[model samples]
Target: MKMTRIFVAALAALGLSGIAWASTAGQREAEHFHWHNAGPFGTFDREAVQRGLQIYQEVCSSCHSLDLIHFRNLGEAGGPFESAEFPNANDNAIVMQIAAGYMIEDGPDDAGDMFERPGVPSDAFPSPFANPQQARGSNGGALPPDLSLIIKARHHGQDYVHSLLLGFNEEVPADVHVAPGKHYNPYFPGGVIAMAPPLFEGSVTYADGTEATMEQMSEDIVTFLTWASDPHMEARKQMGVMVLLYLFIFAILVYIAYRQIWAKVKH
Candidate 1:
């Protein structure tokens, strides 16, 4: 059929595109990682997400901006700071306090000039620098990518991120050459990364008294990034399960009706 041919052609095109993408993405195999949020029924570990947020705040926020996230997002379900007491992050005392710590550029005043004001929960996470030029200039001419959707944007997603974070060290293969100011990381696409090793055994002191091992930080941050990328993941999965249950019940009813109708007819 014409429809069948069209579907086949579309699939062929997709396959070709995937091949092209794979060829250019990287030569190194992405290391597999197990996460708590990996499957259909999976849910986020709230405490781990909170720790990840803490790590991001203390370390990653200096170089990378979480531009797409707002203070209010931290109060939503599946988020690190989500809670029954503070269901609305916009009005939550903690979120309000965190937001107020930053100074944001705002609207024209009576004199029609731009002014700066303390941030609110409604404001976006502030960028570390004024612009890309500033960001690049400060970081050896390489602009740090935003962390907003980083877990989703990369080829291997969170696994790639986890590997890259733990992959850095002083040792490099004899044949590989790393330029000054850049670090060698085998997990990175080109085996060279702009950012240095950001994680260490004691880089962050967790308020929950959890030991801040390198692996723990990487895993926690990845978990937070995953939640940031898809805040509605839990809701979506729940809805999918409900839909499947409804379909199963409906099919059983339809089958019973079909059997009754057939019984009334002659063979």
Candidate 2:
């Protein structure tokens, strides 16, 4: 009886907690947008990914860190900077140039002194802040989440991120009480977000002459992030297609063999 009561109490507590979470987090649904890489055969748009990378470097890198990515990854198969001539990403001239642009801290020298040097292709993208405390200090006590795997981390991630970027409302609703630092974003949990609207018209001039509209920027960034999160998506999809084709052929052969053998025997 005591065990049953304990379990019942636990269930009730969990139910209440779920209800509370729903009250806070379930306010709005993210609007779905068409993504180039949505279906099994869909592939990342190279131009969009490249544009997204530029946006990240110019704007988002100041706050968020892409710890999982290395400069060399940019030149790998299916990456935005990938080239047919350069199979080895480390040797890719474009990747090397991009890496050299960053100042990376190197190991202690023979004199036991740490020093900064030009980054190499193998080096990971540097964090904007030295530590978590510094990150929070810079962003009004809110730590900017690392965006490396954000797409996989969040539910309805692509839609959620796209929506969040454009969700900020200039006019606050009367029913909503937004704190000083927080901005009104109905799409965000609790209808408020610490981060302000990051994108605006003409935020970054596109190299390929694409117009720098907010929606275009958002879509581009999301595409880039999706690629960042799943670099092998295209390869995986291709492999899946091959596997399905192989299985289909094998099944047909097996059926033919079975029919051939059964022909000699009475059903």
Task: State the lDDT at 45 in candidate 2.
Answer: 95
lDDT of 1 by residue, 81-121 (tens): 77789777787787888789889998899999999999998
**Residue-pair clashes per candidate:** 0, 0
In angstroms, how far off is 236's CA in candidate 2? 0.5
Candidate 2 per-residue C-alpha lDDT over 153-199 given as tens digits, one digit per residue, 9 for 90 to 100: 77677888998898885467798898998899888887889998999
Query: Hey, what RMSD does candidate 1 come out at?
Result: 5.1
Show where candidate 1 strays beyond 4 Å: 1-26
Q: Which segments of model 2 are wrong by more than 4 Å?
A: 1-24
Worst 10 residues of 2 by lDDT: 14-23
